[model samples]
Target: MVRRMTMELAVDVARAAVQSCRDAGYQASAVVVDRVGIVQAVMRDTLANRFTLQAAEDKANAVILSGVDSSEFRLNRQDIRPEINQIEGVLMMDGGVAIRAAGSIIGAVGVSGAPGGDKDEICARAGVDEVQDRLDFAD
Candidate 1:
């Protein structure tokens, strides 16, 4: 029943996410948060905008709160309760994705500072993919 994201994994995820953005020819920031929305790791590229840090954190937090990818929420934003928008650390953006371990959400990764939200999301997914092996579920 125990579920948690290790510090090593968190750092690895964050770093890989940032690297993905870099390889895509963008400088960005990436944040990794445990299931409770508590930040576990953060990384900002050398030239990333200062706001990218908060953007990344908010994106990840939004996923944790909604239990859905932030991109999914972004697509259905019009149907979302207005009160949800008022919550702190919630951003209906496309850059956050849930991190599943053993078929359960263990954490999330969010990337920002890309030219577009979709680009940020792409980098975030790359980060998760990098660690997928460690999170494989036993059938």
Candidate 2:
């Protein structure tokens, strides 16, 4: 049986992501999506750009569809498999990360609205890493 992520875990991850972005002085929106691209949590800073929500969702979708982080997609655009990129909601940009636990993809986290894509990616990574140790313990 596949181990499913819980809502509490999703909420914790989202809050951690928001805090990480705020600490970096960048207001952003963070989204968490299940392996199948279903949204689990969405957090937007008070001062974040209005489009942050959509951008975050797009990033998460991209990671889920491609089975790789959004930064990888951005860095390897030419090499990205066409079938993965063709997913309806996927966005080949930065700020998305796939969450893996026990060697299985559990979800994805996406951050957006930062001044630069790299900054967004950094914040997203920080957030994901925050819960990675706990996730490991659950195995």
Candidate 3:
């Protein structure tokens, strides 16, 4: 069977991201998307802004759509087609990261509500690291 993100794993990823953000002294939101870019889970800290969830989802969607971390997109957004920017569910930000399993893009994790985009990205990366073992064995 093709490797795919499970609902349980999605929640684990989301929760881990939120916890990471909290540990980093921020109330944040996190979202996880499947390989197809479908949202699988979302979590928001009580103090996080309402928009944070949407932002997280957009970041994750962008990673899946572009096959690159959102930070890279943000850095090169000027060179990207304006039409690409118009696509719904795309956000050029630093908090989204692609989740790979056995060299295949299996999903992504995104975080928002940190003091800075880099902080948000750090939390998202923590989430990915939380499940590194699972990803490694998926090949």
C-alpha RMSD in Å of predicted model 1 compared with the true structure: 1.6
Clashes of each: 0, 0, 0
Candidate 3 C-alpha lDDT tens digits along 36-123? 9898999999999999999899889889988988988778766774666688888787899999988888899989999988999999
- All candidates in order of TM-score, best leading: 1, 3, 2
lDDT of 2 by residue, 41-94 (tens): 999999998789888888988888778898887777767656555766777788
TM-score winner: 1
User: lDDT of each model, Cα atoms only?
Assistant: 0.91, 0.84, 0.90
Model 2 TM-score, 2 decimals: 0.90
> Considering only N, C-alpha and C atoms within 3 Å, which residue pairs clash in candidate 3?
none
- The Cα error of candidate 1 at residue 58, in Å, is 0.4
Residue pairs with backbone overlap in model 1: none
Q: What TM value does model 3 have?
A: 0.93
Worst 10 residues of 1 by lDDT: 76-85
Q: Give the CA lDDT, 0 to 100, for residue 25 in model 1.
A: 99
Off by over 4 Å in 1: 81-83, 137-139
Quote the RMSD, in angstroms, for model 2: 2.1
